[model samples]
Target: MSFDLGLQNTRALVTGGTKGTGAAIVDALANAGAQVIATARSIPADARKGVHFIAADVATSEGCAAVADGVLAAFGGVDIIVHVVGGSSAPGGGFAALNDEIWLRELNLNLMPAVRLDRALLPGMIAQGSGVIVHVTSIQRALPLPEATTAYAAAKAALSTYSKSLSKEVSPKGIRVVRVAPGWIETDAAVALAERLAEQARTDYDGGKKIIMDALGGIPLGRPAKPSEVADLIGFIVSPRAGAITGTEFVIDGGTIPTV
Candidate 1:
């Protein structure tokens, strides 16, 4: 079953749209009839039709500038901006294991792209008096895994705070700013990680998945969420049906945070 999200004829931009949750979001916004411009460092080999692709590494100032220029030149501006380009490559042991460079890298990846892009594109939205921005944060902001993902968690926490502050400043101007925090999504990378854990533990696939869930203090739903699930929620949030919503962080973690 499906419902109209009222995104027809809108222009949208999705960063990191080549894979995983970002790819899912590109598909969702496009399927809902939005003219989607998906930006990544590289284009996908199996890229689909009806979605425009741009190659730019938005972790830097120049990349964000290129994307803003491209979108404005092509479509004047976008009505929806979904910042999905975030991940941690830092070798994790704890806070002590992280150096200044590692912490800065994580912040650049998880927080600054949205900050830069928003700064670049928001004037168009403000002039037009309407837009929606969604930042893809992580559940780790609330449930930090100190041993492995402390840097990632800290970056996402900053992003959440930034999103809220942006929303407050812009909502009165007709721009909606929201952040989506997802937990334990079953993306390809995550599945591969689970598989590696399984091999190390001499366990099967389900057991490997269980190992991850156990590490997260157990997802009450007993499994990870699909990327498409996160995409669908985002679809609704950017639609007219969610017009009144702004400056909120929606958690889609399969009950992983363990609190209200």
Candidate 2:
């Protein structure tokens, strides 16, 4: 029930850390006694205590370079890097509905930022001979909700593959690369969907939640995960306690993904 975790005084960078799952991870890292720098295109109304905010558009190469410079100048290099910047704006209508621009945007949004940041920062980790990189992917990669989020799912699949390949090359150098895929986390966006579903079904909020579960083929344990719950798992992951874990995809889907 109790472990030191050994994360005191370490530094970390979390993309899209202003809200949702990313904010939860930022808070958890700070709670575990690590210096956390959170990056987003704009500043949040209230950046959490013990977390530094850097305004940068992480979807571009320029943004990644600026963040790398800022962190390198501030902390020399971080002990952890958590890539939690991803979303989908692709329209609904299956793969046919998706256009080149939408696909490009989704790829840049969900994958390239992490790739750019890693290229800019992994050298520092390699030099120090240790670091942990956690990519926040989605269960869509495996489940593929094509009609609604085909591009997003495809990009995440690419990200998962990239994370695994990078880990294979870096673990020997003491850099641990891993991915966390969540299914329907209870963030603001998800809440909005539940509200709409409730309206359509003319039922209570819990009814809407069930509708979502059913759409996903039913989550056996019954509900989506809270942001904080997922953060707790991530907190343990980047800590020294999970020193041996790397090149793996940890799914926190409440048993939504039923497979080996």
Worst 10 residues of 2 by lDDT: 43-52
Please give each candidate's TM-score. Answer: 0.98, 0.97
- Model 1 agreement with the true structure over 171-256: per-residue lDDT tens digits: 99999998899999999999999999999999999999999999999999999999999999999999989999998889998899
lDDT of 2: 0.92
Each candidate's lDDT (Cα)? 0.93, 0.92
User: Which regions in candidate 2 have their CA more than 4 angstroms from the true location?
Assistant: none
* Regions of candidate 1 where Cα sits further than 4 Å from its true position: none
Give residue 85's error in model 2 in angstroms. Answer: 0.7
Superposition error at 106 for model 2 (Å): 0.5
Itemize residue pairs with steric clashes in candidate 2. Answer: none
